[model samples]
Target: MAVAQKLQRCAVSQTGKHSASVIFLHGSGDTGQGLRAWVRDVLKQDLAFAHIRVIYPTAPPRPYTPMRGALSHVWFDRYKISADCSEHLESIDSMCTQLGTVMQEEVRAGVPKNRMIVGGFSMGGAMALHLACRYHPEVAGVFALSSFLNKDSVVYQAVQDRKGQPLPELFQCHGMADELVFHQWGEETGVQLRHAGMDASFRSIPGLNHQLSRMELEELRSWILKKLPLESSAQGQ
Candidate 1:
């Protein structure tokens, strides 16, 4: 495998002093710019996000195991796409390290781990779950759209290894009609997370598909605001 490209990041600068941050990873084969556009066109419609800095990170081009080793922009390589498939830990560990470094940089730049939320779509969401739960539990929150985890995900092991440490809250949303990643798998992921003692919440969207829906984004907005609210100083009071 050729050396993967360096991770790239595109950001939506906050209108006010950046009090909180949201690091959203794009799905496989997608770039940071694409997710950045989606955030600006859709999520930015809500004025409450004016003070929030949204960072969209792009994965480096690497050989994806599922696609006959074809190069794709993915956080990690996977042999299969099902929740029960075996995880590719070698690549997963590397990606987790990169993501961890990103969050640490955010902390040094002013946003504490407690004021940052990490999330993503599809494969990206899986990475978000790994980053928040396995790598950095101090994050404020996590959200995954149409995502899942393997039956023996290291996330479960990491949580169990912690032995009662507080974890970041997680919000998950899945479309009822999702075909690419089954809705049932998303539910199971939630169940497994909860069983592992994670503070996880799962939402089901009816008549939807593998893609995102406006309703889901609205719910995410509400969840984010609740998790990372502005303090008096950051609110420009």
Candidate 2:
């Protein structure tokens, strides 16, 4: 069996009025509850966040791809650290199974697939991107920050399993100064995603590193609200 932790969400419906859900799969080493804190401070402050629930899945230890000098948790192990070749096949398989379990748990809690959005930071973002690109029937959406795609040798097999499905809209952001995952990975990931027929909106924030900014959070909040069945009138003050 796999280890899993539930995201202690901030916005719980008192009478169960949760209209939508955003699942946050955090990067390795970060607590699963970090996403909830992020929402309370940043996303929740936005007008749009009032109508939805955000799910943050906490990953349990053991059996991630090799990362030298870093003992953090990871969705998969992409050791290439460069564009040469980092296969994501193994990571993809593991993540799909774990994520499916998490999604099922949410559905049981009254969250539906169409209304759920998944996202992560750094390595967690990589996992989020992978799920959206490969999972059939798509999902509500995906948001990836400071992450890249895992190159798999058997990618064709994965795609074949998908049967040429259209992917969901992806919102990705990266800091040009990220010391760990190079910023170029973000651009390349966007290019690859678009080539694979995904609607990817990529952004690069100069002088920022790793952490999400107030500005970026606003943009993400806006974009998410637009995608969900939120009230459009909430836009523009």
Candidate 1's residue-wise lDDT over 36-145, tens digit each?
A: 67655765553247567888888989899889999999989988876777899888888988888788778888989999999999888999999888888889999999
Off by over 4 Å in 2: 1-16, 38-48, 63-71, 151-164, 231-237
| Tens-digit per-residue lDDT, 169-230, candidate 2 | 78988888888657886778777666656677899999988777777777787888787765
TM-score of each: 0.92, 0.78
Model 2 poorest 10 in a row by lDDT: 7-16
Candidate 2 lDDT (Cα, whole model)? 0.67
User: How far out, in Å, is residue 78 in model 1?
Assistant: 0.8
Candidate No. with top TM-score: 1
Best of the candidates, lDDT: 1
